[model samples]
Target: MTRSATTPRPDAAPETAKTVSTGLIIVVLAFCGTLVSLQQTLVLPLLPDFPNILNTSSENASWLVTITLLTGAVGTPIVSRLADMFGKRLMLVVCLVSVIIGSALGSISDSLMLVIVARGLTGIGTSLVPVGISIMRDHLPSDRVGSGVALMSATLGIGGAVGMPLAGVIYQNFDWQALFLVSGGFAVVMLVLVMLVVPESTVKTKGRFDYTGAVLLSIALTCFLLAVSKAGTWGFMDRKTVSLLVIAALVLCAWVPLQLRQGQPLVDIRTSLRRTVLLTNTASVLIGLAMFANFLTSAQQVQMPAETGYGFGLSVIETGLVMLPSGILMVAMSPVAAWLIRVHGPRIVLIGGAVVMALGFVLRAFLHGSVLEVMVASGITSLGTALAFAAMPTLIMRSVPITETASANGLNTLVRALGTSSASAMVAAIFAAMSMDGMPAVPRWEAYQLVFWIGAAASLIGALIAAFIARPQTIAEALRVPGEVVATERHEVKRPEAENEVVVGGVVTDERDRPIKQAVVTVLQTDGRHVDWGRTDNAGRYTLALPSAGRYLVVVSADGWGPMSGLEDLGDADLDQIRMNRRLLLTGHITDHGDPLPQVMLSLIRHSGEYVATTHADTEGGYEIGLPPPGRYVLTVVDHPTGRTRSRAVQIGSTSATLDLDIVTGIPRPRRQPTEDVPVR
Candidate 1:
């Protein structure tokens, strides 16, 4: 009904029109991501020499690496959630600022602790990838989102690959301080470009920040990451590691329920648990585990001493060059991945990627005869990583609320980092325990083979997980606005400005005028073409984008309440307070023949095997349970003592309805004598 002054309408004057090219946006964001990721491995080449450089123990120097992982794990979700609440571009700028400040600090300080602190600050930039992906979803035209996201996601691998050689060159020539100074300069440039180029999106969830939940989550992640990352050195059975793990487990046990109770949680646990999001995230972890093995092992394998039969004994610079093609292949495969995602939905892309990765690892396990073979094998895995990485964000965004895209993608990124961390621990353990006998032990070729086999197994497992992701039945279903119901075939309701979007905001309330929190409001054309959908906030407020002004169907549904739908001629006006009166209560009687079946246990299960409700019949055989949104269900009634069960198929409508079940007639039994005391309906 109205437009904000800050967010000019699409038809605004030429001066206010969007002029930035999408290609420039993608490049700016992707390069920003490249710069941020470079921070992760920038100091990696200096790890060995860090003890002397900082006058600290080797273990302390290792924190230069471990600290980044720790802070990245903690910062990503918090920054992502903030991005959704405040603004994506704002957070992007904030992350870059963090990188700039951290880099500057590192350049000026040689103190081991101070540099570790600097690295920790730079780790906050890890949030850049997820937030950048969310921005692309908000800004890019629908057609460009796939390829744009592909290149952005691929940057994670690109930076890691580029960082090694880039850092080696800097370390070889200039002072080590130049590494931080160079990265800081890039961060400064990115910060300036992002402000000048990227548009700050208006899509945001209105809610109070969940500070308590964030604190608890941070503590849990810190403990967990420390335990996992240090377990290789500390021993898995070490008391410190075990204690940290236990603390993390207990804290998470507390955090999940707390999140469930929050109106605006740091993470939407319910949405995250949705079949698509959950499975995609699971596959993400496996993919990360499989993918990182190639990155972690490739250069090391090439640089092994010549005494090792499979070693090339290449210098650091040469090893980095040898591994560089994998990153190049990842960039080159971005368009191909996008094309596959467009032809086949993200589900298929994920599955295909997992399979490719599995085959690549299989090749790695056996094909070490020459540098060319190793490069090709690793490149194949990187190709798959590009595909999988690209598909994951698409799947997640499609499955989550548009308002929570940044937070959702942030969680995906977090799980992926977890996968990478686990891989690091696994590789370290395997190599350490299986090394060749020498004063300075070298990992045997068999150890590398074992790692490759495990990597292959992980990839295949990821493929299996991706295989289980539910596929959308139509192109519209796949591309439906995030947080909206699937579009059903319906007659087009032609109207002016069919291609334009109208911002619709409203509150959902009951007949008593009580705000209904978390209700799903769906806007569709009369013919069932989904326009948009949204979830009410704590105060029952929602916002959506309508495709056009015309007669349309507005559907609202919430837990413990009946669904409501109606038709209205919607135009440049907010779909104000939609009142829902009927509460869906499935009530009926259960009887055995003509007799009441008292105390019978009744369970309503959906056709897809999701449990909806369970209750017990009263002494008079009356039972009532609140129903969920209308769906096909099996109403199963069982007598506890006799263990006799009867299930009747039911179809619930939009409003409440009554259903009387005859238990005896619902189930077939062995024929018995007429005098036999068998319950009858």
Candidate 2:
């Protein structure tokens, strides 16, 4: 009976069941996400009431919202790293609970300080959306993962859009406390749903927590975000802002060296440095800025009075009602974005999204008056944002290892948040700089035009980056390779077989005669030119097609086996078969007598008169070279960093073949002690 080739082990049935469970979890999480997004806009209508209620200036009241943004910027990356280390489910619960407690507190509080604290608490939950998307990825099936991610990403826009109308209705009819009460109630429901539906997801990572790294990262992010978020209020040139930015720079500079030394790092800094990851993250920042600019500019424009030179004069509720179409459009577009990703691939989808976003901005530059015009601009821009957001996580997921998906995606989200924070500061600056009359001047319709032009420019830059940065081929491309080339004609090359044509075939075995699979057989010519080749089916038996062979060096190698080599004459008649004696042990001690050198890679190169075979030592500095036939072999060991090599000749099989050396001390040690018999493979 013909045996089957190796197939990938099927995923556990329970895992499949859990994947289905992710949909419900995402829905619940999205509901909670809605509450978090609602907080961003819920206070917009109440902006006018803040000064009266708190008896504070407008600028002071603004801190209620600003503080939350600042906290969110600080909290996202920290929470993301913790999720990578601990458990995603646990972090989700913690985030939701923070939102619930904050909402409840803000609903009951009369003081502005209490409300600001409540907002900060809610900010913790707001940062969880990216984390939640990442968690869903761990459980969901590949087929379902994209749509699930897109839907979750859409909540970033949906929650904000829906929150506005909801908040407007509550603020107009009931007290401002009602807004917080509704948010708290929604969060409570989400919390319960999450507990019931969300499965536990924790990536296994080895090593102790990098407390120092986390603290430094947090301090740096806080300082950087604070400076960006408050740039308009604290002038860009202000010493306080400049000082904070410098401190942030210093913290980031110090973080790199510390991370490299740690075995288990909080962030995969080296992996994130890849072109695909780094560039995608950079583009995400620009896209985020553009997305937020849409929110800030359109929200303010829609609510301004018709009598004001550039205002449309719609009530808060009417403004939200008019903007409702854009939210609906975003919801409608998400699945389409998911479909585009599946059809064209993520790189194409990302590039297309950037182009579309830029086009939307260009259109907005011309059309910025009626409620309909603003709605159209919002809808168009949101469609592009949805496409880009959906593609980004997919890109990050594909570029990274399965283990680092959540962490990488989390970092991407953090970068995007930086962009949004910067946009907030930039918008404030634009408004501040464009004053016309005695009163705070409304931006002429032309100001919105200038903002859109800037947005278009940023989007174009993102498009160029995505086109250049992504890998040329993906996993799917690799899978399709067999059919990619078509055979037109066959060409054959013939060469004379040597007098001693050794038909070498043998079962590659371990110390025990167990078959080794995929062991490589190398035939080294006397000249430097040599042909190295492989294949021992499930039963490790390899055959080499000789090329004008004379006395050639033959070598055999597998992972656990000690590498073996021998000199053989491939004479004229194909020498029927040679059963390789799996003996000859090459072993050694790898220790830094003073300090442990954990990252050392030990390689063994055969330097016999005419034979050569190479293999590396395992993590423990122990190495084994395997061979089919035994002969004289010279062993050469090299240290990885210094490139210093040591060599010694040893006879194999003719006498008991056992070789040993101490790598750290660069000293030749005996294969066997004077009394102890050397262990043979």
Alpha-carbon TM-score of each model against the true structure = 0.85, 0.69
* Alpha-carbon RMSD, candidate 1: 7.5
Residues 1-681, model 1: lDDT tens digits? 233212432322234345777788889999977986799888888888999999999889999889999999999999999998888999999999999999999999989889999999999999999999999877665566788899998887888888988999999999999999999999999999999889887766656999999999999999999999999989999999999999999999999999987778899898899899999999999999988888888978888877788888987778778877888788888888887877666888899998889899999988998889889999988888999999999899878867788999999999999999999999999999998887235898888999999998998998898888887654334355322223223321222223344455677787798888888887766666556677776777776655445677888878867567778666644455777666667788888896888999999999899988889999999988875677788888999998899887887765556778778786422111111111100
Best by TM-score: 1
Instruction: Report the C-alpha displacement of residue 243, candidate 2, in angstroms.
Output: 1.4
Candidate 2 lDDT over residue span 1-681, tens digit each: 011111111122454454446556657766655666776777877887888987888878988888878777667777776776577778788888888899899989989899889988988876677678777665554455677777778777887887777887888798888888888788788778777887665332223567888789889988998888778888999998999999999999999887765544567676678788888998999999888888878888877667665668877777778767776777678788877766666777888888888888887877776778778877788888889988898888656544446677778988988888888888888877775466475665656777888888888898898988644442222211111121111321112222211233345666466666656566655443243343454555554433233566666665434456666665333432333443445455444553333334544434435655567666666665553245556776667787656666655442223455654565555554122222211
The CA lDDT at 666 in model 1 is 67
Clashes per candidate (backbone, < 3 Å): 3, 20
Q: For model 1, what is the alpha-carbon lDDT of residue 527?
A: 62
Measured with C-alpha atoms, the lDDT of residue 566 in candidate 2 is 65
In model 1, the clashing pairs are 490-527, 593-680, 593-681
